[model samples]
Target: MKMHLWSEFIAVIKKEVVPALGCTEPISVALAAAIAAQKLSGKVQKIAVCVSPNLMKNGMGVGVPGTGMVGLPIAAAVGAIAGDPTAGLEVLKRITPKDVIQAKALLNCDSVSVNVADVSYTLYAKVTVSSGIDFITVTIADSHTQVLSIEENGVSTYIAPQFCSKKPQSYDPFKDIVVKDLYDFAVNIPISYISFIEQAQTLNEALSIEGLTENYGLQVGMTFQRNIERGLLSHGLLTDVIMHTSAAADARMDGAMKTAMSNSGSGNQGITATVPVVVAAAYLGVGKDKTLRALVFSHLVAIYIKSQQHKLSALCGASTAAMGAAAAITFLLGGNYQQISHSLSSMIADIAGIICDGAKPSCALKVSSAAGAAVKAALLALDGMHASGDDGIVTNDVDQSIQNLCALVNGSMMQTDVQILDIMINK
Candidate 1:
């Protein structure tokens, strides 16, 4: 029996699965700046960016698109100079070299300052753009692009609600949902209703192709490709999935001038969840109908796991997202729901405690690593192997196991975020 409305399911996925340029943290900073710029009457002369520790941690070392710079300041400046506010996460998509030059000039003048916010929200970015006499502040919280409020000169201004409906609607899609619900939806939902998911392939695969072909940071994907050519690495679904998934991360983390279809506000998470299934289905010669169903299952499963955890934590989202791929790969491998449950449990057992130091070129390595484990875990699940109930965080119930993992991340690992950020800042 379907326990949730298909409308509810579509709304959740559409809201979360969207396109983002560059790393989401920096791009979010840019979006906030662009919003401020859009509301300003004069040229932007100063910018003040206050973000939560998690935001700073992720945005600090990652590349900003088209600038060859790595940090929030350049992203903010470029966003102010050239970003389009209505474009949401793609605010920096249209940035040009001329815009980069102007942003650098603004930075040289010491016109931009980024500080850690005093707030407690895990995903928060507040950008204040000024034209000397007047300024606008745009704040996004909880979600990457969700604008909590817009203010001009310390007074709240009216901005159309981006995600709100004319009628108040509760959007707790995961409140009572489980993996079984995801399976049912993926299997029973009409293909036309979920075909929009194919765009994840269209957007993410381009990033992989660019990352493999170009000398993006670390070249993790290209490295796998090279090894395969020389017989150093066996070329197959698993290796190819890892290569394709990591390549997208390499391009995204290196600020390759392309957009990624982000999942749960992280582009690498989207790539990890999408490319593995896409590459696997292609390698296995799966049909479009089955592949699309698997894609929906993969992405929704990723979203479901993420919903159980903090928006950002010491927990590497790549692992959680890869669990989704694990479930999908099991489905593609002709495993039943019980095998899928084993795959999820196996993934939790395999990567229950991966840390997210921050977003960087090495993130591709993590995505690559997790994608491989997901594939391996799925195969093992097919063979009736999984984490024992007595295992650290695994349990007889998959849902309970996921919550245990979240408990660890949202509980003790928060301090890990602080320690990691401390080391990063001090170093």
Candidate 2:
């Protein structure tokens, strides 16, 4: 790869892969509220938060970190009270017990109101904080943490040109990336440039341990381990992958005060992409360099696939991240590019249409299922078995098959997204 291309790839990875606390949907809300709070001079008396439908859907039931509370109201209240906007997606990292109390009190008083906004973007958050007669507004749109506008006292203070024009240029750094390019980059790229990928292993592994040790969310990982101890499941690579990945999700979805190395704005997706590959690398006795390379492959594949869809979608992101894990596992198993492609195809064929209801404790179950399916797909690929082009969305070309999956999620599942949100809201 050319030095320029390598530099671009590294930059994209750095931007996409970073630490996040709690579910990103709620974090985005909190971040916006925090920014609005920063602009206020007096103590905040009220807050009005509006978000896109996708954001509303995902943030509805997920736990807010350090608050022991679920949904957007508490997230907004805590953010307005104690969140640090400078921390970006990790905005709630500074939330303390006192902050949680204040947030809960604010909720009890009905000082914070959350509603779905009429917005075209998949990711959007607008938070307005009031202190007596003065108010400040902060808006984040397009991507999580991308603040598009800020206003104070009903006056525009700052507005992104793209926000005004409403014709934001699509800047996809991975636009030219294909499966072959990802493989070549993973194997041939200099170690020094991509070595930082190891942080994904470090951060996500800690969350996995935390989940197993404590009863967080569904305790999916702990349950799996207990099942293995009871001789119901084998103690092996597949079990390890499922347990670690699910455990990480369990902690993340349940609002454990730990940072997850998020990919494409999702901690669960990051866990699904990293834990399986890390477990496989350890099981295969791979060294740091090879493990780092495989981790990069897995993350890059997930980022590339997700770049084609909305940031938040009706389709379960774990399935896409699991496809990345399957590719990495295939690479670790000494399978070539063809086999890696086959693994991705197998994954898409099996779990391409799992609808995302919301981000909550049950997400751990979906994460575990995706991880197990990833291992199965990798094994099938290693044995020279794969889903044919005739299978549902699988295509002869791996890249084309990925595009087909994206089309289904982004286009065909549009109504599915709305209906799922309706069901959740009405229920």
Candidate 3:
């Protein structure tokens, strides 16, 4: 890779991978509400929030950190009362017990309302907060925390035209990123430049440990550990990988107050991409440099694949992130580029169409399942076996195979997203 392209890749990683305090959908909503509240005077008497359908679908069931509450109403109320907009996705990190009480009170007073917006963008949120007759409106679009506009008292205070409009043309920041390029960069990049990726391991591992040690979500990771201890499940690399990764998801989805190093605006995706690779590298006793390289490779692969799909989609993100883990595990196991590619193809072939109902405790089940599939896929790839091009959505070219999977999620699954949302709202 050229120096310029390498620099761009580093920049992309820094921009896309960062710490987030909760599921991003609700955090983004909270961020918008926080921004709107910042523009208001006196106590916020009412908060009305409208989000894109995808946001509504995702935020509807996920827990908000520190509140032990699920869905957007509480998230928006808490944002108005205590969120720090400048924190971006970590906007709710500062939320306190007092703030939780106030937020709940606001909800009980029926001062907070959430509705689906009539918007074209897959990622959009509009938050309006009122105090007496005065009101402020803040909108976020295109990307989480990318505030599009802010209006105060019927007067526009700030607006970015490029992001404010709904007909914005598609933008692909990772257009230059390819699977081969990712492999080469991960292997060849200077250790100093990529060492920052280790923070993902530290943060996500902490969440995993919390999940395993405490009862959170469905306790999938804890259950795995218990089963292993009781001799019901084998103790090995595969179980270790699933336990660590699913535990992280368990804590994240069940509202642990800790932050996760998110990838592509998702904590679960970050955990899925990082923990499996970390466990595999440790199990193999790889050196620090090699472990870092494998992690960088895994995370970059996930970011690259997710770039091909919408930020929020009907497809479960764990499936795509798990493919990245499979590639990393293959690399750690001494598999070459061809084997890594086969691992990715095998993963995509296995879990191409898993529906994303919502972000909730049950997400740990999918995360564990995807991690297990990734390990299976990697082992198969090492043995020179994988899904053939004739398999559904699997192409001879790994890149084309990824594109085919993305096409299914982004284009063909439109109705699936709508129907899922309908069922969720009605339920």
Candidate 4:
């Protein structure tokens, strides 16, 4: 890739690798609400939220980190009470116990209601706030940070969402990236950017430790660790890497308080892509540049998968990200471009159909399983193995393989996604 192209890739990576407080779905709700709150004058009294089914699905079940509460109502309340819209996904970063108390009070007064939109989009949020005689409304559409409208007192300040974003650009990951590029980057990027991976190591690994301490979630990763101690599996770099990485995921999905390094908005997805590659780097003793390159490859592959998942789906984002981790780990382990492609193909072939019912503590088991599969896929690829392209949704080309996986997520699985949410809410 040209230097300029590399720079552009780096820019996109920086944009997507942002810090988020709590689960991003609710935090995004708070972000929308905060924008309306900021526009309000005098004392704000009432707040109403309108969200699409997809947003409501994610916001419904996940625990908002720091607060024990579940769902969008409290998120909106926190937004109205203490959120800073300008802070974006980190809007709730400053939330305190007092703020939580006030937010719960707002919830008690029946201040929030989430209704499905008449028109469906992958992402949407509408927030209305009333302050005595003053009222403000804000709508977030399509993309985060791209608020479509803001109105107060029957007057509007027109700001186009396009103004905040550069002209629309399409990304072709394979055009600029091949297995060689991924491998070289993993072997040669700077330390500073890759150092962020440490946060994944510190926070997620700690959560894994906590998970083991308390026997949280399905105990998949922790259970694997115990089996290793029993000599069921040898103590090797691959085993250690996969175990530490997925164990943290086990803890996080099971409601550990630790925050994950969120990528494209999902915490478990972030952990899935990050921790595995970092653990590989640690065990392999790769230099900082190599580590950074691996981190970039891991993170970007996750982002690309997320673009297809589009923030909502029956297909879990962590599964997609774990596939990316499989690719990155393959490259880091001296696999060629063919091997990397094979690992990705094997992953999609194996785990492409897992459903994300909702954000719940039980997600840890699913995530650990995915991570374990990813490691296995990478190992198989290293041994000159590849999933047959003729097999179940597998494709010969890497990009086509990604497309096939995404189609299962986006096109053929909408009903499965909606039905799961219905079951959760009705039950």
Candidate 5:
């Protein structure tokens, strides 16, 4: 692979995968609040935030890290009170119990409000924090941490250049690429060039261990372990994959303080993309370089597919992330590029319709299901069983298969997002 192409691939990975402290929607809200609070004088007296409908939907039910709470109000309040603006997505990391108390008090006093913003971007947040008469506003849009503008007392202070970014659509580096480009890059690239990618394993696995050892969320991952000890569930590669993958999701969705190496702005998607590949590499006894290669392949593929969709969609992100896992697992199984493509098609065929109701404890179940399907999809592809064009969405061309999924969600099923959010808010 050429160095320029490698640079592009690395650019996408660097932008997409990073450490996030909580479900990204709430974390982004906290980040906005933190940035806004930083520009204000004295103690924070009030916080008002407007987030996109998609963000509102996801943040409504998910846990906010270390606060033992769910939703964006507390996140914004705590952020304004104690969050670190420099921490970016990990803005809520330094929050103390006292901060939680103060945040909850702000909520009690009705000093914080989170409303669905009528924003042009699908993923957007506008946060305003007031300290008596001193106030500041911060707007984040297009991607988490992409601060669009900052204003103090109605005077503009900063605006992001958004160098490569255009309107209504994100910049697309992979527009001319396909699965083969990712494959060649992962396989042919020097191992030294991509060794830093290993941090994903270190970070996500910590959450997995935390989830399994302690009680968090639904305990979906821990339950599998107990079932195995009871001889109800067999101890094998699949179980190992599920235990690790779902455990991470369990801890993350439940608002564990540990950061997850998120892909495409979602912690669950990160867990889905990372854990299965890690477990499968260990199960196969692959070398460090090989494991890293598979990791890059899986992550980039997930990023590629995920970047095509509305950042927050009713289409479950785990579906695309797991497809990446399926591809990497097949590659580890010593399958050729054709089989890797087949693995993706098979994954799409099996897990295509998994709707994302919202982000919460139950998301662990979804990631686990998608992880299992990934392994199964890889195995079927290794056995030369590809989903042909005759199937519903799975097509002869892998790229078109991906387009089919994107088109379905971004077009006809867009109302699915509206209805889902309406039901969630109403409920």
Candidate 6:
């Protein structure tokens, strides 16, 4: 029964935790536009896009997959011109050079303007399109790709928030994975089932090395790796794992064409969680079976931690990923379930409130530092040195500890979210 439950859990996680084509914010914009455009059912002559400051700020600096452009205008334009809503987060995957040209034309016509919405929601985007004879407006809010309302001409063809009663839900592949179930899947799943984990290794390791050669993100991972050359840090599994994990963030944020397997809609989270374990496996010369288990632990733990926080929180998603990385590293270092919980607890206490400013090349450094801290936390746990409940936010029970983290991000951090966005906009 336990094995069956775990298998089912892993299935759900694998389905939810997959690759996303672009940065989630602009993709949400394009997705809303595509739906509205499809509803128009005619030639799209004009398109207008309105977005919240948070969405605009994030979408402003990140790359739209397969297109070299950044920001909401192009993403909105492409959505109106060529995007398919059915593609989900990868909505703009089919964009072509012709589509890019057409999108630019739409922008040149002064059709896209980003403005703050009166609503105080963390996630929001509204797209309105006008064809020759028809006009449609679509609104996405509170969650990425949540189309709250839709109208065509004067008719409300789709009334979502009222008639439709579901909150905007993200693609959560790890929704059902419990810690024990993940452990079982790691220990018993066929090696073939997790061969994809190796790709995380290849892609991320390349990025870490590239980061050292060039300026990538905070250069935290590369800087640490370089310490080995200077004899400041020892050459070992920890160094190797951090290097590989951070390198991928460097590449992805710096606009590398290589694809990364994303988790809960962010590629950096996927890299931070998976690459470190993969590097550890390589450095320690671990067998495929053990390696697969460690990778699953890392990935599933990251997914679980992400579930605790609202997808968009005052905190950066990396903090959650770092917790996941820390747990995975604990397992790699021969820590059992108890120690895994300890590492997670330590991570929760330490990095729970790190805010997400935006996705950028500099994110690599943050990822590296987080991964390094995760390693330390895990090592400490393996030695039976865990954060005491009396100190900080650490709790006696692991699940309750995570809930405490969720409270901080979801319940207590609203002001912090607004303030961060305000500062970014002012800067």
- Model 1 poorest ten-residue lDDT run: 158-167
- Which parts of model 3 have CA positions greater than 4 angstroms off? 1-3, 164-173
Residue-by-residue lDDT tens digits, candidate 6, 177-240: 4565566667677777776666555555565566667665456667777888899898776677
Q: Which candidate has the highest TM-score of all?
A: 2
Q: Tens digits of per-residue lDDT for model 3 on 316-350?
A: 99888899899999999999999999999999989
Model 5, residue 330: distance off in Å is: 0.7
Error of 5 at 110 (Å): 1.7
Please list the residue runs of candidate 1 whose C-alpha ends up more than 4 Å from where it truly belongs after superposition: 159-171
Whose TM-score is higher: candidate 1's or candidate 2's? 2
> Roughly what TM-score does model 6 have, to 2 decimal places?
0.83
Model 4 over residues 227-309: C-alpha lDDT tens digits? 98898987776677667766776666544556667777777787788778877877888775666677778887777667766
What value does the lDDT take at residue 381 in candidate 5?
A: 92
Runs in model 6 with CA error above 4 Å? 1-4, 38-45, 146-149, 159-185, 188-235
Question: Which lDDT tens digits does candidate 2 get at residues 1-427?
Answer: 5445667778888998999999999999999999999989999999999999889889998988888879999999999999998998899998889889888888889899999988888899999999988999999998889999999999999998765776867666676677888888889998998989989999999999999999899899999989988999987999999998999999999999999999988999999999999999999999999999999999999988988887788889998899999999999999999999999999999999888999999999999999999999999999999998999879989999999989988787988988998898899
For residues 288-363, could you state the per-residue lDDT of candidate 5 as single tens digits? 9999999999999999998778778889999889999999999998999999999999888899889988898999
Every model's TM-score:
0.96, 0.97, 0.96, 0.87, 0.96, 0.83
- Candidate 5 pairs with clashing backbones: none
Estimate every model's Cα lDDT from 0 to 1: 0.91, 0.91, 0.91, 0.74, 0.91, 0.74
Cα TM-score of candidate 5: 0.96
Which one wins by lDDT: 2 or 5? 2
